[model samples]
Target: MTVNARSGLPKDRPAAPAPPPPPGWRRWLVPVGVLITLVLLFLPGMGRGPAQVDYGDLAQQVAAKQVDTLRLTADGTITGTYASSFDGGEDFVSHYPTGLQGVDDTFLSQVRDPSVVPHFQATGATGSWLGTLLALLPFLLFLGFFLYIGRAARKGMAGGLGGIPGVGRSKAKVIDAVRPDTTFADVAGYEGVKRDVTEVVDFLRHAEKYAAAGAVAPRGVLMAGPPGTGKTLLARAVAGEAEVPFFSMTGSGFVEMFVGVGAARVRDLFAEARKRAPAIIFIDEIDAIGQRRGSGMASNDEREQTLNQLLAEMDGFDPATGIVVMAATNRPETLDAALLRPGRFDRQVTVPLPTQPERRAILAVHAAGKHLAADVDLDTAARATPGFSGADLANLMNEAAIVAVRDDRTQLTAADLSQARDRIILGQRQGANFLLESEKRNVAVHESGHALVAALSPAADPVDRVTILPSGMALGVTEQMPEEERHLYSEEQMLASLAVRLGGRGAELVVFGEGSTGASNDLASATGLATRMVREFGLSPALGPVGYSSDSPQYLGGEQVTSRAYSEETQRVIDTEVARLVREAETTAVELLRSHRPALEALTRQLLEHETVTGAVVHAIAAGSTADGATRAPVSA
Candidate 1:
């Protein structure tokens, strides 16, 4: 078995056979035929015929006694050989008036001399037929060219630029019933998602078994998740494992500028799938056409028609036919109810972000052939990257390799991975040499405050690294990596998180007696966290145990404007509680900074000198030990 160099998956399918070569004579047939046709079309005009002159020029030449012999036809064509002392002898052809008695008599009188008279011949039917055929040659060629194009378009060739004839054909990429390039092994994790889809594979492989037990397979499976969570990959893996024909198309592929085009495409897609009975149809990003239908100006008639067609096709197909439809979408909430209803999409699978173990596996899959140093720990990397999807993990591994290459190294080290993580999360590091001395000192102090608070607070996550170097939009950064993933947050943890977020502003207030614009991000984060704690988490004493926040989708990362369910008076109280929580957290941060002034100063000095300090050093300093292992008096609040 051969392995894919990039993905590290074994090639499962046999190599396709090369097409047999055509016969040698057949290869030259087209060019020879084209040559023969061209010769036939222009052969009569190719020989040394008379140089055709205008009627007036011929009249002038004949009037000057330049003609040796002339032949005139009843159709008005004239041909002759002329001799001139200045130029030499030449044969020429011209035309004169014919079937007009007065014009012919006048021309004949002008060109006729005492010694010479033009010979006239009657035109034959053969000449007339040849002239008509030559006149219609260009139109015939044009018609033939269009006919060739129409034939190719009907056969769905020329990259599917099928023109009018293929407008209603499905644009799906059809993979045949041979094993595909990807399988379950290619996908790193999400075992539950794999299992859920594997059942579909089994049903396709053994349809008779399911029928014998009177078990009906699901008509459709809907994979809904945040973007880049491997929903589409899962569908492909299902097709690969089952060794069935796979028809894949995106939701936007069905939509077109013309009305009813989308509906026509839907019909074509289902009909094609039916032709290959045991096949799978996978549509990605189905929400584009499957959006909730609305009546009014807001409704899109074309999109609604497409959705209606899709609904009918899904309900029209039988599961026992061994055909299954799979779809993926990031915005499941936007999908129409008819698309997700019982008999349509019977199973809705949620593919969420990878957990820590899953992330480690994903990293390993991406790290297949990459060189890593001994200290490059994947577990540590996975632990640090919480809420990362499989795509993110893959990107992280690639970024780490890039960092290694940037440093002129072949193997990725721990520092390379760290830098890669920082680059992804906090943006690239900016040159600190351009910073003013006062600004540098202020940034060091701000980050030191955050580090000290996080190290001292038991509920807060451990401070991973603190830096005064500017990165992205921040003047300083203090990163805290959680030891493990936590699905639920206690009230204490929430309050400690708020304090850690406010620590920078608290330090600025304590040291300079005022807060700078550097604390803008911290202030915003603290305010939001405190509000969530009070309103959503119901951690506020004044608000009691009732959750007051609106029901917005959590996975969707945007601020949604929702109508408040409570009255104006309750809103006022909620606002007061939110402010109180933020104030309490800030006060706690200020008191902690005031008490551990020595540790804060020590940490800030280390940051200013080295530009970065680790969590261990901060913890040591907070515990009354210098960074270089020197003992110091412990500071307490």
Candidate 2:
């Protein structure tokens, strides 16, 4: 259901909003004109007939030039008869000497054509005017037909009224405030974002406080977040909270193949926003219009015009009138600098990924009425998920309920929750994907290394699940469930985490004497984590606590701040450091494996049959190494 522009609350008795008017003339007139032209320029048909002749009289005329016999029957009908030197085919042998050859008197007594005797007395005839007209009509009809079809062909080739290329049109969606479902309560994990945005809403709700303080309220709020992180939702929530007319649309909505449409729409939007005065304008994914200009040879004049109008409108607005503009985008890097500066988008708020505690809270929100069994622990579930966002948490709850329903259960079980986590992170189990037994064994060993190292390290996160089932990229995943929600990770903790990642490839080298290409994801992850450690965190021997990113512009338009975070002389050292970190962990694992080879073999056998085995199962086997050690139990149900 769509929202109402004037009211923030869900409209109990919905208003019949007027439908948007039809699009530009290019959408219809061009097509209709082509159709008319085609009909007007069409082609027509032609037919054939045989030659008419009279043989007896023609031959006689040719033989005797002067006494030419006429092979004519009275009333212009004639029949043929063969003879020497020409003969007259008279209707009833004319009473005079008709210049007829082989005329015999016996012929009259032999037979008589009964009907012929009556018509023998008649003579003389005219012509057929209708037939003559028909014989001359084909050329003009054919000319007109060709003309019509040819015109149609030309129009079809042109493709548009003006015959322009690149008919790429942007989508249009407008948000109304009345039917909006998002509230401040629906948004999760973005406290800073919420606080900053709440102020904007407050400014919209009560402008006198800010104005009286001589601190003019923000003209525009730029919400920056990755996709699916609810920047759009927050914008709607602002309108919902403020109780004002909200004009919501997308950045792409204004753009068109015709150059000036975007700029025109920008002017129209702000004009309407200002007219409404105490109003809010929300543009979701506004970067489509605000992208950096002059990056390539193509002119950004169209976008520039649109942005210029937007900037002018934003700057020209009176603070007392209470017009708040809000826009959201994932790529802040791509936006124009002028749009992000003080007067235009006066404030920028970011909504990032949810922390563990936030995930638990989000899960609780979704799990409220679902029969999630008293034994279901959201805290544990949250800890089990590391990179989950608000949307992911919502899906996790929904998927758990689906699993419950599929299992024909009245309440969601711990096993169901575990399965939900698996489905959310890895993927649904494919029953029969192909894999050689040898390759499967190798995958099992590789993932086992990750789970083992993660479990063994005191600094590492709690191990969640290890599986050989493939998803988007990795063939297997070793999910590490954290002990609790953590605000930050120490430099030592980050290093250990890197070690855990390398453990997979390390184990491959330890056992098989060489690493397979299966470790591509692992290597990429390790490299990224290590790079951040040096460049961002300044944890390298070559560099001090001075961050390289600090010197780099917030807009990232500048150059390098150092001669590499680590130099060519240090490249080998960094590689050695990384390799040293990896090797030490591998040796530890290999020694551990050597001591508990039997357990590793048993677990690998179990994985081959199950396709997925949880952290609890692996921990059980590892803990079983001791005669009296307690296994890490599953989250109880």
Candidate 3:
């Protein structure tokens, strides 16, 4: 039964409390405008301060003994406050030339006469630049202080301004549209995943029906898959289908350097999600915080608190409230068990790599915007990519478009797709290196050997192309084409595959009477395959159905710690068996090359002439024909 069938929660509930306000353009504009106004008001204004009086008027007043006190500035400006009975009392200011020493002396002489003397003393300088600046310093300080405050207000507390309290607030991005933009139709594959999520969406959309039937909706669904497998996209599609509020946040968004901060965010996120009932809360990359508790050497109090808060929220929420928590993580193996318990993330859906038909659907979806040439067959492209995720397929389509644009082509052709695939698989192919004729011949012979062995071996994949041109780290490459995906390989196929890998060195040994460093990659690959066959696949008779290697997490870049499960004696036997397998494969490759020595020579000559030889060309040479039967013509470089 689906999660909807299991849920017995009621649908009827009262209105929720008001949610914390979402940030918007209006919220930002108010504080930003205030800051801008403060900036305008605080900028230095035009014109001088106070009233002005001529230097002559000030001297006449001094001559009449009307001034009570006087002050002179370094810039030759004067100020004096008039007596109580005098005009312009206490607020008068005046400017005079710096060369007015004669006037000042005359005034002093007049003042010496007791009867005409005014209470005037040469006080400290007034109206100096430094003095004026010092006078306005307090106002400037106020303006700067306010400007900083305004900026802080505009950015909100999340900019680390609000201290511990602000950091505790939720960081979820709420989407309250009638429907999300990305529907299930937009997603390409993972039908099983879609079905699992569809049941949740149906329960959300029709909760009353399920409630009437005494069913309660699932509280949570966890999506576990490798990166780029559309986990997040599927969550969006679920939201779109349910037509409810969607609150999205990454697991890392809840974490902070401070203790209890992540927990606060977790509480805040759930509180807001509850405010919008029938909502989908999606936490992407949840393993960031939900990692198995106590796994680290030192304690991660912040992450642990966040995980605990999440667990509590999931447990505390009523299924009747119509809040379903959905989370995605590439490293599901690292998540805490509490987070995946029955009432929490009740269902864990695995979105695996697309199968053949699923891949075709993915290709078709990604190809919608591109103009494809008639020769571009999506089915063929799908068959070529065995382990590509949905994101990889999208990237492939984009790379194909880029290839088309680079080549100045109007539409994407089969050749563009092929080149894009090669670029993704092996790094970009390099131009011919400036090697000697002998070196070139050696590379051609090596590649030809690989193609020859692959074609002649009973269970080996067919050779797709052989090239002597440098590509990435390889000086030569022989691409193989599997007709279909193979999950379970027989012992015969594994041995044949191992022999094909060793064919380059076998040919080098037969032709040059010694192997060069050119076979380093080939030997490494053959050794790895042989080791797996003996230790992991239990293919060695000597090892006798024993698996000496432990399995690691499946996701790429996941923890790859593999401990040997066997004792030292078994390890020695394993090493011996792996070496024996490699030797036998090499021997088989050498025998095949020797038996078809003439064909091998002919294929090597073709590669030398063309610089690149198609698989059709290799097959023709192996079949003693000059024309490529597969292509109905002589294939070129």
Model 3 segments more than 4 A misplaced: 1-166, 317-320, 434-436, 551-562, 626-637
lDDT of 1 by residue, 7-50 (tens): 22233347567756856887897899899779877887786877
Give the TM-scores of the predictions, in the order they appear.
0.74, 0.65, 0.74
**Which 10-residue window of candidate 1 scores lowest in summed lDDT?**
1-10
Q: How far off is model 3, as Cα RMSD? A: 8.4
The lDDT values for all models are 0.80, 0.66, 0.80
- Model 1 misplaced stretches (Cα beyond 4 Å): 1-163, 317-320, 551-562, 626-637
Could you give candidate 3's per-residue lDDT for residues 138-169 as a string of tens digits?
Answer: 99999977676566557554443344446669
Each prediction's RMSD to truth? 10.6, 13.7, 8.4
Poorest 10 consecutive residues by lDDT, candidate 3: 628-637
Superposed by TM-score, candidate 1 places the C-alpha of residue 196 at a distance from the truth, in angstroms, of 0.5
Writing each residue's lDDT as its tens digit, candidate 2 over 286-313 gives: 9888887776456677787777767777
- Tell me the number of clashing residue pairs for each predicted model: 0, 8, 5
